[model samples]
Target chain A: MLFSRPMIPIDILVYGIGLAGVAAQAAAGVLEAGRKPFDLFGVVIVALAAALGGGSLRDLLLDRTVFWIADQSYLITALTAGLVTFALVRFVRLPGKLFLLPDAVGLALFTVSGTQAALALGAPWLVASLMGVVTGVFGGIVRDVLCNEVPLVFSGELYATASWAGALLLIAMKASGATPGTSALAAGVLVLVIRLGAMRFGWRLPVFSARL
Target chain B: MLFSRPMIPIDILVYGIGLAGVAAQAAAGVLEAGRKPFDLFGVVIVALAAALGGGSLRDLLLDRTVFWIADQSYLITALTAGLVTFALVRFVRLPGKLFLLPDAVGLALFTVSGTQAALALGAPWLVASLMGVVTGVFGGIVRDVLCNEVPLVFSGELYATASWAGALLLIAMKASGATPGTSALAAGVLVLVIRLGAMRFGWRLPVFSARL
Candidate 1:
């Protein structure tokens, strides 16, 4: 029964990652002209980035098995998402204004995932939190780089801040005796809410030079 | 004595990776421009891909600390390599044939490095070998994509094959009690020899499909 309970959360993470990956890739692919479907290789690359990039970074930093490699589902999911996106691109117009919500969700999940991994490894809190932020954001950074754009991590908006807060909060809640799944859920929700609110409200960070 | 002995090999691996990274970056930066320094960002991106891309993919897949993040020297060396190569591009010209050697060598080292990481993580030998090949070739694939070209990996070359053979050999030797460093060195040499031999002899793989 305990083992079965864990599967519920893991499934949520898996399914969410797959759906978000499809949305992100479809959005990115629309950047391509509809005159041609992205070649299989390119589309899959985008999907993989959108899906696994963040979590992969987190796991590697925390020295844990990458979530995808442990179970083949992530790869198959990304592959399926890429194909479905490519096939359906002609019929859908992605909502440009709300793109950050899924990105935020992925980031939140990855951030918590990274924190959980680091804590499992018995790393210090600072290391755990930092790894979480890195995990949540690194994939998008990579995706942007591969796509020849500057990464979200470097640019404006509350992208990373939202994830960071959720991760830190998850760590705090667990330190105070909260259940793992409940803490993770709360953190994930925080990230999703912050990210969506930021996008919807036009929340912006200060200019690059202002902090100094 | 035991600690120092391990440290000796570790130092060698790090130094070798750094050198190979620099050489690979310089070569890629030049090839990227085909003998010109185009844009600052583009050259740097190519250099980063050449120097760090292989190892990054290896770490991501293996779920290990990214070698670059663990050691900032790799970044410094790559940046320097790209600048120096850009500055000297006007004064030096490499024969087209000579270029293939380092490309193959980079692939070889990357493969061995990846294979080693995978083995250390207790991956199955087959998976380790595949990871090795991925490490050796993925960087160039990334470079080509960023440079807006189809990857050499999917093109008509024995690039991945050389790395794959070298990795399998390394793993076989290691499993039989050969020291890891020695196995790695032999693999690198074998890959280099095979790759260069193919180029020098003008060997090509037979086309798979009858179509153009």
Candidate 2:
């Protein structure tokens, strides 16, 4: 399905968004792993996991050819972005918060794309929506696990919630007969807004500890 | 391939071994997660991840219908094993070392089965062998990740190495025109012996730290 058509304008736009999201997540992965004393290979592994792990899982579940294997661009983009970030960090001390904006954008784009892909494959609504959330947050979860920390998505501000909300909205819009492109755009905007707002205002889900 | 000849003696043996491996891994998962204060649901999630994650990943990479989804018995076995382990642990104080034997068996069975599956699907030798290692270890990695700990396989003993060695052996045997059943049995035995010996003698790979 990915290479059925040559680069039409709409295809270019969608592909561009996907690449940007991958680059953002790869850079974020490098920054997160930087706190640990990992070597370059370790850092690159984290970057690839953060950038591609979620979508790989989604494709696996859907029984599709893995995207990076199908098209080498995504893989190349992640590697280049990771190496650049790794180099930049050594020379210019980057603030931890510097990635938040791009990270939010990546989350939004991934969510929309994942949900749409699932929908196209005729997955049920709940499954499609969950796939969206998975694509948005699972990469970060993997990055944290490699770094030996709790997944930030499990406890961090409104991250997965934002993705889920936007995913559900996308499904709803599609069901209401909206065009695919328009529905995707609206859902992406919603996710970006919610994520950015959450980061700014400390919005969070209730944390609980159950001793049982 | 799994159900083409239902309940033949050989099929029964293979299927039974698969179920036992899943049950063993699920029980191990519950015991590991017991150290954390996760609720029943959380524990169950970890158990399922530990029991099924490896095979699921291998199937996805090989583009096969997921084994559990293709056959519900594996799912039922995993759930039953997890719940039983959870209950048993609450009443009986089990030693951490108690699970090593069954875990070793699981690693052996999963590694052989995964390699065979990949080879059956026409995967190259390297990919098939790696699939075996992935099927042997990825579940434990997922379980540890969910529990917010570094994956034990990464540093503990010769866990992955044993699996990889046996996987390569399996590939070699198959290439030498050994019967699938005999090759699988030999490979499984090799993995079990290596893993148990590693545990008994405390064999280890060199750990390294690089500052760059």
Candidate 3:
């Protein structure tokens, strides 16, 4: 299946979704930074890492021009969101759970995009699925690490699994001759639903207690 | 100043240094993982991250094939080091200071190599210098972050600065028609000496304390 060619004029929709995803990740990054004793520079750096790290890793692994390097819109969006959050953090009192919805949306959207890109690059299905999960979670992992906390995705139930599911669904739809738009949309929605459900249900993975 | 052309038969020397660097970083990764509750898989992954993350990032940014993709020796080295450390952790007791010497050597070797690669790709001296620092410290940053610690390089004094110094020295010597081997050897030694001194002297950058 040709994943690069769009089936319809969904550029605007895709752009909007991508921007929202960036904003969501940036907000989450800023919130994470605020929870620590980060300065303005550190906050901005972490915010950028959270919003862009996954996509950058995907592009790098695929040997493609980094999206932000090619288009300044992503950079501007991420930086703006980060800066605004940093400025308003003192006045804001968001419930911790408020981050879940946007995080799910971002994860879903990035997973679809990452999978499509990997497929277009002729990567194996397994590699594509892994890429999808990497694109969805790497940003959060970097952010958490920078904040000296364990990565939530490592323990968060159904996080990477949701991305893998969405990526597989997209590939399956493509194999069945579905249009790229339909496949991406369906896969993204599946991921979002699963992630939100996990969040709402307080789903968690079983921890392996290391016995030395 | 062609960076790729060898001025002398230093292939064996460079190869040996690179492998030692990889092993050093991998051992450090294993030690860090052992300190945590990481499984074998996590230990291997962290080891790979520490040994290869910097070079991978440099290649990706410069649009070069990832080194490990083109060569398997590095992969084998990192994995073996990690596995060995994991198996022997209970039997071996190491003073934390034991990691510093190997870390310094790895940082120096990687900085010179990263700078040369960037220069060969036609990057400016400043960019190459920054790449050197990135290549030197990026692996440790990944290791620390994955282990849920603040990256030591961020606050560690004279770490990246030493890389920059070495990179600039290499560039200077190259521009003056020095042999690539001479420049690389000298710059690497400078970095190693400076980093070792910093570690021994408890050097650190001033912390930016955010006022609440």
Candidate 4:
């Protein structure tokens, strides 16, 4: 490919991110409400809250039907994941260190998804990009709220910043006309790299305001 | 004069609610932050989050720049109240009980406001009415999340329903050509009466599901 053109299609990258986000939401839901069993409605509520909270907020802001509501598969997958988690918790015990990896993966992917959605909606690049960051991080914020923890976005790990960086990269790739897959790869790599780098180097965004 | 129409105005009720909500958020902020010396940013954040969380969410869901953001007065009042609470908490031995009174007041008022906004936006009466209930109660829900407590909305109380009933009253009045002010007053009184009645008598709503 010539330097003027790009590698890896943006569409493929976006598709990967979409699938990853769904999987991540399902897994997190399992972890959250799976420990306890309630009625079908209760279990589904928790699963959907964990999976769709951030996106629903985003769409509500944009005034659209929740994406998952339109795509029944996402809801079904989340329900199945939660039920399986509730049933299988006794058999599966992962190390605490490994537990958050799936969530992190989903966060990274969701950032890209949000950005893409924003761009498609014709929002200015910055707002679109920030919306992406919000999309990636806020579901967990709601999850934590429901779980009674100060949002992880507030305390540590260059999470929001990393999500923004990934979104920004994807946007740039879009501007440059990189293939959809290539762009998505660039975005995903951008997020994972920044996050891992921040963790390894103990990087922290200065707490500008104590309000959080 | 006649009992043919619902009594009380929602606008007056909302005004009272907005005022009370501002106070509750300020006090709750101090409590949530562990009685720390919150700078202006800290107190304002707490106050605004508590005061505006519900209304903003309702408006955004309705696609509007939260009333607080649109009008600086609400912001000023909320921040000022927060600052006052921060300063006063250090010297006065105010019992937490005082907070309940204002929170109750705010909740009743906001429920009407939410319901009215929804109706004005031309939503179905049912949706509009529910919106009012959401507006009235979502702030407390957010506050609970911030404070690391289970949401009062899901707990045993007639909180949202009181607001809903009042909202429905407002919508009904408006649909039948009642002036906005008159409709507001009736709605507000209805909310106040129901909420006050519930609190005074230890009223609770049926919980469809139990916490496991």
lDDT agreement of model 3 with the native: 0.81
Question: Which is the winner by DockQ between candidate 2 and candidate 3?
Answer: 2
TM-score of 4: 0.57
Least lDDT summed over 10 consecutive residues: which range in candidate 4 chain A? Answer: A1-10
lDDT string, candidate 2, A1-212, tens digits: 66654333447766887888899899999998988999999999999999999998788777767778777889999999999999999899888887788778888988998898878766657667867987887788789888988666656578888998999999999999999889999999999999999998988764433222
Writing each residue's lDDT as its tens digit, candidate 4 over A108-182 gives 778877887767666556656756876886776676565555655654657777887899899888999898668
TM-score of chain A of each: 0.79, 0.93, 0.91, 0.77
TM-score order of candidates, top first: 2, 3, 1, 4
Q: In model 2, what are the clashing residue pairs, if there are any? A: none
For model 2, report DockQ: 0.12
Q: Candidate 3: how close is chain B to the reference, as a TM-score?
A: 0.90
Best by TM-score: 2
TM-score per model (chain B): 0.83, 0.93, 0.90, 0.80
Model 2: per-residue Cα lDDT over B72-176, one tens digit each: 577778989988888777667767676678788889989998998898889999999999999999999999988888788899799999999999999999899
| Candidate 1 per-residue C-alpha lDDT over A82-121 given as tens digits, one digit per residue, 9 for 90 to 100 | 5665555445654444445555666677777778878988
**How high a TM-score does candidate 1 get?**
0.59
CA deviation > 4 Å runs, candidate 2:
A1-11, B1-55, B67-141, B150-212
TM-score of candidate 3 versus the correct structure, residues matched by position: 0.60
Off by over 4 Å in 4: A1-10, A32-48, A76-92, A99-102, A122-130, A142-156, A164-190, A201-212, B1-52, B56-113, B121-133, B150-212
Interface DockQ of each model: 0.10, 0.12, 0.11, 0.09
Candidates sorted on DockQ, descending? 2, 3, 1, 4
TM-score to true structure, per model: 0.59, 0.61, 0.60, 0.57
- Point to the candidate with the largest lDDT: 2
